[model samples]
Target: MHATPAPPALDLPAIQALAAADMAAVDALIRRRLASDVVLVNQVAEHLVAAGGKRLRPMLLLLAARALGHRGPDAHQLAAVVEFIHTATLLHDDVVDESDLRRGRKTANALFGNAASVLVGDFLYSRSFQLMVELDRLPVMRILADTTNAIAEGEVLQLLHVRNPDTDEPAYLKVIERKTAVLFAAATRLGALLAGAGEATQQRLHDYGLALGYAFQIADDVLDYSADEAALGKHLGDDLAEGKATLPLIHAMLHSDAATRDRLRAIVEAGEVEAMPEVLAAIEATGGLAYSRRRADDYADAAERALDGLDDNNAVAALRGLARYAVRRDR
Candidate 1:
């Protein structure tokens, strides 16, 4: 029998190590800002923040800032702001999705009550704005404002597509780009801005973040079906249960034969996965997983290319590695 080669190692740990100090600074700042006079606000916000996450978005900002030669308090401030915005979204998403679990733990809405979760999410949004104003840069405020607005718009768009069997691949891609990629783009662009990087460098980093965000979200969608709940940190088939016709499902539907397509359409329109075996089988028969993986790879390649001709350094190398890790990791 022929020998099989092992896959290359993931660079996430190395990237985390490289950015450790700054990430710690960001974490400390997040903790300080999360405090509230109201007990409920404090309890709800702190609960979610205490639940550990990879902090990837904030790390992206810190890394991009350092890569562009910025070492200052402002980057830490903005990184905290980014995290608050992200956490706020999670609180709201759980309430909207009626999700019970996240990160293999009960969701804020489940544990804290839906009203409390929604109110705390609003608190985070307002708190993020307060932090943004402290930065005293109008452009920074502008970018964050626009990015947050776009994310809200994306949420609405996603709601429109729920249980929508007709949702096409382009519509789905647009949702991911707006909901996820824009924030990543804002994070990197903020980094370049903080470093006083020129327009061209900022554009390159922005493109890198945008493409990376697409890759990351697509891979996440794929994992909804393929990953173990423990590894994925969320309920398996949560997307399907929510009637989200993500890339894999969309691709499978497109490639399936008439009978398979009808079965999928009925399942999707009803937003039930009682026939999960049939759905998985159809996806496999149609090569949906392979197609989604290939599409993710293409975006990862674009992200890597976006860094072309930038200054060569550990930060730059980490950014390159991050693009690959976004797609290759199981969780």
Candidate 2:
């Protein structure tokens, strides 16, 4: 049997060209900071780091800072800090969801066991705080500290919503807003803050990141249903398998008739894919995927709008490209 070909890379030439040097510095900082004397910690951290992701969050911070004419070295430290926080969450998230795959590779929890993954995740969190302290900027620390706390709350809220077929679009959006977008907002705003940008500019960047996060996450959820497993770099139906009623299911439930909705609820509650074909069919019939994508596009539009008053530069253009890519990416 032949191996399936990997999907084409996500288009990010503009972001790449603009952020290449900063990203390299971020990567170097990541490698330097992730080092641990403990064998298990080093092993687990290295494994996940090597697994490789687009590092988009840190890239956003770097771009936002440069776009605002920030020339400080502190931005680099903060960018690495944001990436560490993101990786820590992925570690814990996989453990909580019992996820076995991510980014087309075995998840840390899957490869290293839940105990190791969780502990290493804790290590990353602590290390990130240590980096935060290095900056000695109270406001930046406060934003990250509050953002992390909100993310925890979002995780708990999502836990409550699991297997709950009645989870509404508003409830789901709130969860993503806290769990994901808050951090994105912090990342972008921190850049503006580092540059000593005025309150208005900082707020605009914050709004841009917040809207971009929503678009990015909603598009991600849609991919769970609409993308091929190889292209998605994870199993299709993973969300359904975990019994999470994300926006696709939420929209499908609302649009479905009583009988179809009842069936969908059963699948959600049972957390099984035995009825996946039927559930997907119902979602397709009711235009769930289309609805979700439309919602994502709306957020992307909001992100672009947030950039309207920013001075024109390559970094600003890259930010716009990133907003477009948020909704358009295949993985």
Candidate 3:
């Protein structure tokens, strides 16, 4: 791989404006749905929400909606819905992965314990469905319900893949499509649907979101080995340490010598990366990071291609910029 110029940042102010508007609406919805005499519910919900996050889902929804000429308030409500789905997933993810750290901080499961986190996650999931009913849009409900199920299936598949170093790219891609791309597909597809766009336009947005998600998750996997721990806000090589068979390991195995391949395989199968430095070295020696980045690049390009039928707009331009950044980010 050759050195490439960095992708430009989105006018964060623009994204923030999008975030703030969405958050205001989302907050209102959250408050209304969460309003309860149960003190524990509000406390747990607040803890999870206040935990730092990029609000990427809502931002994507806003950008997609704007790209398709949404001038009304539907985007805000929908944006909140997107966030609720994402947050609930995180809550459940921490529980399932038994993760101690996220975004360089203790996860809700770590802080609140698995039971609270899982229950809160359940609350958020049910709350999102309640909000969907308020929208009175059965189609949106179907999309979200289907997306959530796919995500759940993805998580289970990933659980199955752990400690199995032979997990191939095809298997991994299926997990990504479910765990990551489904929500992305839902977010953008909802934007198109809410805007009353043509079916072709709706599908284009859906494909774009799916590809973008693939790029995003692949980049994140690459960063675990390539990025500084400080920059990542978590320990580097966590996935390898956890025995997850991400793209880097899969690609490395494809090209490594027998001894190197065994070493890599052993590390994951052992589920304790005491030899992480050696494993990272082996992966780097075999061009695994480069291979992963290239695959991520292909997904990013696919996302760009999906926009071929959409009318040009700032939101579309920003999304293109974001797709570029997704694969390019160092952390």
Q: RMSD for each model, in Å, please?
A: 4.5, 6.9, 4.2
On residues 31-120, what C-alpha lDDT tens digit does candidate 3 reach at each position?
A: 576655777778777776566567777777777878888845677777777888888988898787778887777887887789988988
Mind giving the per-residue lDDT tens digits that candidate 2 earns over 1-331?
9954422222488579768888888898999999988999999988988899999999989989998988556888999999999999999999999999999999998888999999999999999999999999999999999999999999999999999999999999999998899999999999999999999999999999999999999999999898988889998999999999989889899999999889898999999877889878988998999999999999999998898878777788888888889988889
Off by over 4 Å in 1: 1-10
Whole-model Cα lDDT of every candidate shown, in order: 0.90, 0.91, 0.82
Query: In model 2, which runs have C-alpha deviations exceeding 4 angstroms?
Result: 1-11
lDDT of 1 by residue, 1-331 (tens): 9754323323988888989999989988998999999999988877787688889999989888888889778999999999999999889999989999888788889888999999999999999999999999999999999999999999999999999988999999999998999999999999999999999999998999999999999999889879887888887888888999999999999989998899899999887867778888988988888899999999999988888877767888888889989998887
Kindly provide the TM-score of model 2 when superposed on the true structure, using C-alpha atoms. 0.96
Q: Per model, state how many residue pairs clash.
A: 0, 0, 0
**Segments in model 3 whose C-alpha atoms lie over 4 Å from true places:** 1-14, 17-20, 31-35
State the weakest 10-residue window (summed lDDT) of model 2.
3-12
* Overall local distance difference test of candidate 3: 0.82
Task: State the displacement of the C-alpha of residue 231, model 2, in Å, after optimal TM-score superposition.
Answer: 1.2
Using lDDT, give the best candidate's number. Answer: 2
